[model samples]
Target chain A: MMHINDIDTPSVLIDLDRVEANLKRAQDYADMHDLPLRPHVKTHKLPEMAQKQVALGAIGITCQKIGEATAMADGGLTDIFLPYNIIGTSKLDRLVDLHARVTLSVTADSTDTVAGYAARFGAAKPLNVLVECDTGAGRCGVQSPEETVELAQQINDAPGLTFGGLMTYPPRGNIAQADAWLHKAKAALESAGLPPKVISSGGTPDMYRAAEGTATTEYRPGTYIYSDRMQVAFGVGTLDDCALTVKATVVSRPNVNRAVIDSGSKALAADAVPAPYTGYGHLVEYPNAVIIALSEEHAVVDLSACVDKPLIGDTVRVIPNHACVVTNLFDMVYLVRGDTVEREAKITSRGNMR
Target chain B: MMHINDIDTPSVLIDLDRVEANLKRAQDYADMHDLPLRPHVKTHKLPEMAQKQVALGAIGITCQKIGEATAMADGGLTDIFLPYNIIGTSKLDRLVDLHARVTLSVTADSTDTVAGYAARFGAAKPLNVLVECDTGAGRCGVQSPEETVELAQQINDAPGLTFGGLMTYPPRGNIAQADAWLHKAKAALESAGLPPKVISSGGTPDMYRAAEGTATTEYRPGTYIYSDRMQVAFGVGTLDDCALTVKATVVSRPNVNRAVIDSGSKALAADAVPAPYTGYGHLVEYPNAVIIALSEEHAVVDLSACVDKPLIGDTVRVIPNHACVVTNLFDMVYLVRGDTVEREAKITSRGNMR
Candidate 1:
């Protein structure tokens, strides 16, 4: 058996203990709130973890794409929720094939997407279509509660589609506004005799505040599984809760004040946290050291502020700003606890954009 | 046979015509300067494209990591230059194996990296090591020209290591400063009877300014093949010169002012160009329209500036801010000509961080 330190540099390491603890804590919170936990596979992108989530009382797994859902299905996951508008012929065709193999639910904010879903699916094997409401996030969603019901009614009246529920990627700071927006939509949906069975609202920033009495039936927080620096910046989790980290080798000490690591944007990702937090990532070993700049293959770290700096050959663990994007960059991640390497998990759903 | 439009959304499309033209133009510039052109494979990560570049009069290819070089070597590429200080034991072992199969030359800034190379390699099959110098770029490199020669002399004296050359990733918009820096180092090396054989300097921003009558012999430019929005901002090429693009479908039209595409940070990476160029990408069909925000799987477009907006089912081409990082995000790219997809080229070097 190999040890965790024996693994090569610029490798993603997942603390299995933290993962298990994070999973349990989130599941316990959802259980207490009476909301079904649907862990988004985007965090780890490994089907094994998704199955573990299901085993630990998750209702289903949320996949962002058909390819991700297919990967999860291949890994023996049965229920998948794709929280996006499934468009185009090739993608819809794959969705149809995936629908045959698993219980799949998808969301669409427009009638055009609903029509596309209806054209492929029939009443004999109905495809559950959820109306994605904008809420306060202001990305892709129905602008109003009336628009949500209009799209929901279209799905209900369509040949093969069923108005499954409503979903939204809520605002970060003020999630109650999202809950209130969905509450209005849910009332409109109920008035149309189409009360949603699943009202999904998600964001790691407000994972603890997944509304209790409102329309949100399930919570889909992806980053809660592998809490990153971005979640840390939002005050959602601490550095101890961060399950994912990039183990990079200090390849060069360019100057007295600077150290360069092997993990750049290609390994750690280019996602950044908000102000008060600086750099692309935080060095776990040296808390004061900031990863100032990232080239494609090298991260120039500022070590001036640190009392102790890493040598040219020293290895350090870095907590990335965003865990989900970091998972997408690598082909596999090493699952470990302490110094032991448990197993290597393939990032199955990475680059499954279509 | 499949048409380019027949491919799914958020897929990387590389235009063969533009690629060939870009190749010819860059090679022609190199030939005019009497400099050996070695296109870095980081942009495409396709060994096929690297092989094409070699066939188009390129000296060899530049890879950032040993695994990337290994992929190109497996694709029948013989000469590979890794412009990085590779550290650690496992990476060194792989480097030895890769060195055995190809003519490999690597860069080292510190004695620690040289010692690691000397430990694995033998005097019988010596490894060529270049000294990386920090010209104005505040990244990974020796601090001064004196430091460059010191590292070079150390490599020259070390067992089983030959001082190959001097290389620098020059600061953008100022190529002369880099040339002057390398000239000082070359003179110092000559005085010490360790004159360099190959001097390399590269950056897509100043690719056309390959120094002549200076210490620099070969030039490496990664993004010149598939020029991105960043390169365009640097005034290297126009948007039409971009061979690579992401074809994304408009999955949702939430309001009159905003539309959302299926492409996001997952497909088109989160790398942003400097000011004056905003957004994560540039839409070819709607130049005025801005991709205002990006979630993991959705790019929210502000279509208010556009006279014609994309519909729910329309597909649009996007030029990402950094084409190299975008290539790292995908598994394969569709090689296209006109409306037809020529072939699906596997991004062989993607996720080859180790």
Candidate 2:
């Protein structure tokens, strides 16, 4: 085994023990609720880590893109759910090919998307389509219960496609709204002589507050595996549960109150804003130190609180503002156990942004 | 030939014709100045693009990391300059290996970094070291010309290293300060009976404004190849010269004023700060619209001014805030000529961050 110091600076380090602990915690929550846990693999994007989640009794995995699902399928994790609308012929072709190799299900919010998937897969390789309901998170999916039923009915009638379930990712404070939306959509589906067998509803914030009795049979939470500063800010997970961190070296100490690290927007990632984040990222060793600013190659961290300030060569670990985007910034992750690097895993699906 | 529409969404599209034109413009500037042009390959890490620069009469290519330089050397580019401080044992080992493979030169400001490199090289393969004088960039490098000379003397006397030259990335509007510092440093070196050879200077912002008779024989500018929103904000290039743009699909129209694109931080990158600029990125089609915010998977563009509103399935292109960092976000880039897809080239050194 290589020593932790032997790897490289500005590298992504994952504590295997902490990751396992995090996985078990989420698994325990799912077990307690009697909900099928489909851990979203977007957080790690490494096959080895995904396999570990499967070993911890995950039903399968969830992916955001067909490219990621294909990578996971190629890595031998056969069951995958892509909770994003699969649009365009290029992506649909890849989806068709992936469905041939794996048990694949995708989300749809419109008749056009459902019909496109059905036309591509038309009874040849039937795709499982989940009706994505927009409970609160106003990103994608159907707006109302009526639209959900209309899309579900279209999926049921379309050739080579099976309407398997209802899926949604609600806003953090609105679990009740998600439950209400799912209930109405479920009732509408049943009244139309259709039943959703797999009702998947989850986001990291609302996963713990998930209501199982209200048409949700499975939960898909990606960030729960390796919660970040964003999750911590949202009250999703404590700082101790953050499994991955960017180990950076202090490259410049130009002033008494501030220092610059080798990790900048390129290393820590630029997904540092969109509400509660005060700066670029959070310093793991120095929690009080705020990353006041960032350049493409330098991160300006204010280390005014530390009694013994970080010097020009000191190494510090940083938990990025958002973990999922940070995961896509690296090619490999060092799995560390104490002072030893136990393994190096390729971020095989790191840049699969199709 | 793959049609332009056949490519997947959220993928990097490079206008090859525009890229060639940009390259020719930079080459013409270098010729007019009678200075060697070292195009920084950190913008586009593709070997083919680096070769194209070399074919267009660039002296060499500059890389920020040793891993990127090594990849370039492996791909058959012999001359390379690493304009970053090389610290740590793992990086030192790679630098030694790279020096053996190519005509390698690196920048350092501190004696500790220079000594580390010198000790590793050990006279067997003497490494060329350039003293980096801080000309108000406030990032790295020596602050004073006297300090630069002291560091240079240490490198000159070191058994395994040769003091090659002086380099500084001066802040914009402080070109005179850079000139004064380099002049004083050059005088100091000459007084010590050690005349430096390669006086490297120039950043993209100060490329056109580089002062004459500053002993700068070679100028390195990376972003001149594919200018971005920052360049436009800095009044460096027009939108027509931006060779790269993210071809994104309008995935959701949540409200009348805003529309969300599939390209978010993961695709456009989060290095969208630092400038006379506002917003996350610049929309190519709707130039007036502000990219109000960004999530990991979504970019919210405020399109209130456009007479024609974007639909859920409309495709738009975004010129990212920082083009260089954006290039590092993908594994491959599609080279396009007008509406035609020309070729697909691997970003060979995309994640080489050792």
Candidate 3:
């Protein structure tokens, strides 16, 4: 068995213990809420982890693209939900293949996306289409309940598609607001004679505050598997609950004020945490050390305010601002328990940017 | 033969014509300045691209990690420079293997890093160690000219290391300040009976302002090979000069003002350009469309400003904020000219964070 430090610098280390606890906590929360959990595979991008999530009672898995769903299917995942408007002939072709492999569902905010699915798929092997609602998030979703009902009607009318339900990428920390929007859309769809089967919702902090018997029958939380500094800032989890940590070596300690780590945007990723929380990551070793900036391969850290500073050649572990993006940046990650390295997990679905 | 449009959506599309022009322009500029252009391969991560840079009269290629250099060496690159203070034995072991494969030189800012090299390599094959200076960049390097001389002395005194010269990742748009600092360091090194042979300096914006008879012997520019929005904002190039572009399909047009593309933080990356220029990237086809926000796989575009808003299923190309990080996010990219697809180039050196 190898030690955690033995792994290469700038390598992603996942605490198996913390990951298990996080997984259990999320599942337990879902169970208490009486909702089926469909963990998004985009977080880990590992088929093994997705399988583990399913083994712990996840109804299925959520994928963003056909490529990721295909990987998860190949890894023995039977059901997958892609929560994005699947467009183009290339992706639709892959979707057809993935649909044949597993029980697949997709989301659509426009009739253009619904038409693509209807064009290829037939009534014999129908695809479930969820209507994505804005829900005040202002992202890729229909603006009003009327648009949601119209899109759902279009899906219901299509021979190859079924109106699965309503889903929303909501504004952070507002469960009631999302529920209200989805509730209006659900009522609208009900009046249109296309009663939804599953109302999907997610986001870590909001998921915790979700009330029972809401329109949402299921929740899809991706980042909770590896809670990050951003999640901590969002009032979801603490720093100790964060499972993923980037192990970087201090390549340069230029002065008493600053140090540079090998892990920069390329390794740790450049996704900044939602406000109030400054810096790219939380230096676990040096709690007060500020990761002021990041170049492609250099993480410039301000070490002056810290009681202890890292020296050149010293190893430091950093909890990144965002864990999902960080996972995508690495080809493989170490699953560790404290100082012990368990095994290397390949991010098989990484860069599945279809 | 496949059309460029026939390629998958959210794919990294490289305009070969634009790439060739970008390459030639940078090469001509370096030639005019009489500086041996050592193009950093961190931008493209393709060994083929690195070979092209070498063929276009680059002295060599600059890589951040040993993994990247090893990949380049495997692709027939003979000379390599790693502008990083490489620490830890895991990396040092790889360095020894890479040293045997190519002419290798590395940078050091501390004695700890120099000692690691000195312990590994012998006098017969001494490693040329460059003393990295701050020069107000304030990321990684010795703070003053005196510290640079002291580190140079340490490398020179070491049995298996030769004081190669000096290098600095300087502040943007300040070539003179960097040269002046290097001038003082060069003077100090000369007084200490250790005259430097090479004084390397780089930064796209500052590189253009670099004058002849300066202390900088050579310049390392990575993004110039594929000028990004950040480089454009830095006044290095315009949007038309950019070689790399992300082709994404309009999956959702929620309202008259709101549109969503399949490409998001995952595809375009989250590296924000230095001030004034806003949003994730420049929308090429719809120049006025603002990519307001990005989730993992959803680029939220605000299209209110545009007169000709893209309809659903329409494909749009985006020139990302930072091309290097964007390149790292994908495994393969489509090389195209006009509407004709050339071939798929594998980003083989991608995720080489080690």
The C-alpha stretches of model 1 lying farther than 4 A from their native spots are: none
Per-prediction backbone clash count: 0, 3, 0
Best-performing candidate as measured by DockQ: 1
Question: Which regions of candidate 2 fall more than 4 Å away from where they truly are?
Answer: A123-125, A212-215, A252-259, A273-277, A311-313, B187-196, B212-216, B252-259, B273-278, B288-290, B310-314
lDDT of 1 by residue, B2-84 (tens): 99778888899999999999999999988888899888999888888988999989998999998888888999999999999
Candidate 1, Cα interface RMSD: 0.9
Q: What is the per-residue lDDT of model 2 for residues B259-334, given as tens digits with 9 covering 90 to 100?
A: 7788878898867545667887777778778887776677878888777777777788888888888888899999
Clashing pairs in 3: none
lDDT of 1 by residue, A175-203 (tens): 76887898898899899999998888887
> Per-residue CA lDDT of candidate 2, range A1-354, in tens?
788776668899998888988889888887877887898888899877789889988999998887788888878898899888777777788888888898989988777678778889877678999988778876666888888788888888888899988988777777777788889988888898888898898778767777543678998888888888888888877888888899998876655777778887778876754466688887877878888877656788887877678876778888888888888989999889878998888988888888
TM-score of chain B of each: 0.98, 0.96, 0.98
Query: Judged by DockQ cut-offs, is candidate 2 incorrect, acceptable, medium or high?
Result: acceptable
Tens-digit lDDT string for candidate 3 (B5-122): 6887888998888888888988888898788888889888888898888899999999988888888999999999999888888788888888887898999888788889989998
DockQ of 3: 0.86
- Model 2 fnat? 0.42
What root-mean-square deviation over C-alphas does model 1 reach? 1.4
Comparison by DockQ, 1 against 2, better one = 1
lDDT of 1 at B168: 88
State each model's CA lDDT, in order: 0.89, 0.82, 0.88
TM-score of 3: 0.98
- Model 1 scores a C-alpha lDDT of 0.89
TM-score of 1: 0.98
